[model samples]
Target chain A: MTLHRIRGGPRLSVDNDRCERFGTCEWEAPGLFELGRDGRLRYRRRVSDEDAERAAAAARCCPMQAIVVRGVPG
Target chain B: MSDGDRIVIAGAGVAGLRAAERLRELGFDGELVLIGDEPRRPYHRPSVSKQLITGAARPVDMTLKSYTELDARWRLGTRATHLDTTQHVVHLPGGEELWYDGLVVATGVVPRHLPGSPRHDPRVRVLRTAEDAAAVRRALAASNKAAVVIGGGLIGCEFAASMRQMGRDVTLVGHARAPLYRFGPRIAASVTELHRQHRAGLAMNTAVRHWISTKETFGLHLTNNQLVVASCVVLAIGSVPAVDWLRGSGLTLDDGVLCEPTLFATGAEDVVVAGDVARWPNLRFDDEPRRVEHWLNAVESGRAAAENLLAGRGQARPFTPLPRAWSSLYEVRLQTIGLPALAEDTVRLADGVTGFVRAGELVGACGWDRPKAMLYWTAELDRRLPAPATTPAPARWSGPEARPAVGTAP
Candidate 1:
């Protein structure tokens, strides 16, 4: 098995301190990061490849530079 | 990801990231190096009010994308100093230079610093960066008596609402009459009403001419010869293209980079500029090169530049003009579609909902808790509706205003 996962993704994280919560990432990636009840943020449970790209778009579109994406464990 | 064909990008904002994503989608499998001066991943700006100021969110959780997933060399915290576009090389601030076959500069705009104020003043701030938002958020926690917002545009209005919610006495001072009067009177009214409803001070048609500095207090001198005192000041004045580094570079700069129709530098070259930094003329808007500093425009423009870089002239689709942007402030959802910047008239379809329209079609609209009305009006905008009896100024198109001798929906 290839140790490194391909371009597929199932993970996302954000540096909350740096996040202005601008919603650009959420606009770009709706299925990934859900603004919780607190209006803060949390990742959805399942993130497929297609939705992952959208999430990536939102993450890239974020102006505050506050997300970190991890693939399979390593 | 190999630098299969090394593509150089400057300014690590939304434009750069959107372009990178488009390049990958277009199957440009070469090396992608994204250079940014800010040493962080891209995040959002809209949240500075609702989440960060309310302490509902944090910056780390708000990036547009995580750095690990991007298939690019992250040259973060490095400024691209010079562009020898002719030599196909970009110089960095650290004395290192990199060669490029294609370049996209999404440098974005810099927040206009408060004029005549000491830069090191702890109470002074601008809400552009995540850090800036956090500073403003933190400042409001202690003392938010009267905040002197230097601009009365969308950002200032949105902040006024957020501060009012946070119990901060806010004063929005702008040089324009009623602020954004050109954006449509209804929108300006809606914004003004929101501030008034919250009891915040609205100082439209007013200017922060200068500041009188003292040991602990700084007084803002207004053009009306009035002095307003505040615990802190948040300057939301307009921004300018961050083109200082490109001064000596031969690239054209009429306001921002005067890009050709294809979003390229005036002279023929591999470098391309997008987002708020490039003055991209819209064909639909009479070739007026507008540098819209909105999120949607930034993403759309960035994607177009990336696609062109990947496919050159052959395979890429034409960059259609972006749809006008929308926003949410003070529980009001404001949307602008097409080009309202060139509109000569406005029509309010729903009660309190206003749109700039002309000749029986819709162009730009600002709705107050009525997105459904905006959508219906948007669908009926281009179609031929019966003409209004009046001059079509401030009349509904599909609801109640379109009836004259016929008594149809306006």
Candidate 2:
């Protein structure tokens, strides 16, 4: 799993083995997911509570279900 | 359940490859073989139109996984010529025969081009393969001339958007006034607006009567006598199933290989089908069999088919997924759920989501740039929809076991 952190934000987990770089996550949550050059998907593990909805949408929209979110409190 | 059991999967696309992987994941320690006509490994076909064409992704980047990762025999660049159902064998073009206890037909679909058109000509291109996309990219980069897209479907509209973004003059021609005619007038109008926003020319409600080609340039003479001259021509018309190989196999072949509710091929207990080539009755739409040519359906179908292959007929659950597909063009993204093709009436909701109705019921929904609405509607539709009949005998694979409940199937 590829992990990235933003210190005081929700942690994001991306299973590199399952990620196919379709870039659907990028559209759902632009602040968290980025489609880099050569179609590499880069993401920040930590996201603010306000952006939690977008983060969850990214996870749901992913065809491969490669994205997993953690530490988002209600 | 023995290790000696062998499974042969025809086609190395997402459907075929995933079925093999799922079988392994499900503790199937059997011999697995994957065959594909394409030389390269299984890649994300969706990206070939959007990211790959725009130079945002490389050919190698489109691959779903490293071809070397699968624990199966690879037979790339080889066509499965025929299926000998009586002998449980798949005959290849070179007299190579593969015998298996289980079989999966996942040959997918082949791009449909203009009939009688000179496809070998340098100016013509199709975006089905990586090579085809690369060739178009090279052609677009080399010349500053206007490009013509011969279809008004999703693919054609997408290519027009991509090319126009690359600073090329693009003209999109289609028979309908709007690009996506099946999505009703409002959605089509929105798509028309999307292309118009990019200043791409649209010759809608017209047909290409003939092609005029010379050594220097090519032209498409429209029915209205408006000749469209261009350097490159892309046939984004659509595709047909790659089931020509299974013609005499005795399986029901309509638009694709027809399968039972459990994803098994008709009349064949050991044979299953997946991906764009498998036409099974989706439990959501009242048992109306459909063949969805989207990325997610292919993967999920393969995953379900793997379980069905192991569980056999009655023991396996049905494959009834809520159909959803998304496509992005320029800055706008369209997320659709349920059956967009069967929608007869559409109502534009206040939240930018369109409710697609058929027979006085909301059968589907599409959202344009409405991410939040897409999520809500997806869940709403899944809950509100009627459950597919459990008592009626299936078209095939009808057994003694009781049908499973909705959402619990597969």
Candidate 3:
């Protein structure tokens, strides 16, 4: 009911439009990416500020570069 | 004309070809010319060790794009002999020349060769290209039972898997304490365990000090004073930068063509060192430039190089790669993420030798006859939970650390 929803765990998230889904992120760090009920990617809802660099790696690895993870206290 | 800028890609391997494909998709309008040393189109290099050797897949499985499909100028079978940065030109082996506005060197790496032996011997084989695949196929087909694989790198393991699938006894020799110490220890331990459980001869802490070769077989002498007899020896020790011709080409060669964090070599402002030819620093792991020999690294480097070529120096970013690679040995699939530096923290995630997460991200992963749990965990933790400000690879990834003796193989 907020302006937007961050529904998954904090570790990672992706913007489908931005995410080409190169799957490198998943290939590198699978713990943060999972198949949701819809079989699309679901990231951890709340990655800490500490997890920023690694979370960004998972996002950057996306060939589509579509991953836009927020809320890392950056 | 739909235009960003032209991208002249050198070395038509996975990296080079992928750069072109991504370039077209990314909407580059200027002329796209792909130059290479090989005669055929770029094909998949990874399968050379896995499928091509076993006769399960043909050399064509490595093909990324067909000639009919690519929209670039394809110089089939042509070799680039010289590059002039002052003129922004590339000289070819066939007395041809090309003037380019932007250059991308995706010349991939070649299989490392024995220091003394003839590179093209019937007894010894190194896999890197489609032609190399042909030679490996012939050698493996003739290898009925035993194959002594020198160097337990990813290529070595995949080749070992192929030989073992043919029911051949495989002795995988590595000079390190575990397999793939280059990838880090946790993943290597898991790999060593998997190979052992799968009944492949896992010879760790062993090195092929030298060899005595006959026309029909190779007598492998180990550093530990052990002798291995096999008709064929597949050397998957490692790769050498394919920059032998780039000598005196004015590029700084430190191991590979050392690139700035921005991926530029020397001489031309438009030229970039990509793929295995360029040693670019990875901030994700070590700050020092490292050259990784894998399909993804090649593509990533090529794409970034081309993008930076069009974007210009003002906006370019350093080329840092996330260490990611995978291998198929029989039914087991092993993949890893992160530059698993020698770590101080490694906690096993599952009892099946699945993996140890460094800083809670899937830094290294491995498995046995079956890697179900490991793959699942790998996908789950591709990013660390509570995403840290800085990754944990340099801090958390532990190595030379003690691991339980984990092989069921005699």
**In terms of TM-score, which candidate is strongest?**
2
Off by over 4 Å in 2: A1-74, B1-4, B66-69, B386-410
Residue A14 in model 2: lDDT? 95
What would the C-alpha RMSD of candidate 3 be, to one decimal place?
13.1
lDDT of 1 by residue, B17-134 (tens): 8777666555455567999888687666567655666565777655665333348898998988888767778899768989887888888888897657666877788877777877
- Local error of candidate 1 at B249, Å? 3.0
User: Positional deviation of B347 in candidate 3, in angstroms?
Assistant: 3.9
Best by DockQ: 1
**Stretches of model 3 off by over 4 angstroms after superposition:** A1-74, B1-6, B66-69, B116-120, B143-145, B182-189, B284-286, B342-345, B349-410
How well does each candidate superpose onto the true structure, as a TM-score?
0.77, 0.82, 0.72
Which model, 2 or 3, shows the larger TM-score?
2
On lDDT, the leading prediction is 2
Rank list by TM-score? 2, 1, 3
Candidate 3 residue lDDT tens string, B254-317: 7888887768775557778778788877655446777776566776787677666655655566
* Per-residue lDDT over B87-117 for candidate 2, one digit per residue giving the tens place of the 0 to 100 score: 8899998788999888989999999978866
Clash number for every model? Answer: 44, 1, 42
lDDT of 1 at B12: 84
The better candidate by lDDT, 1 or 2, is: 2
Error of 2 at A19 (Å): 11
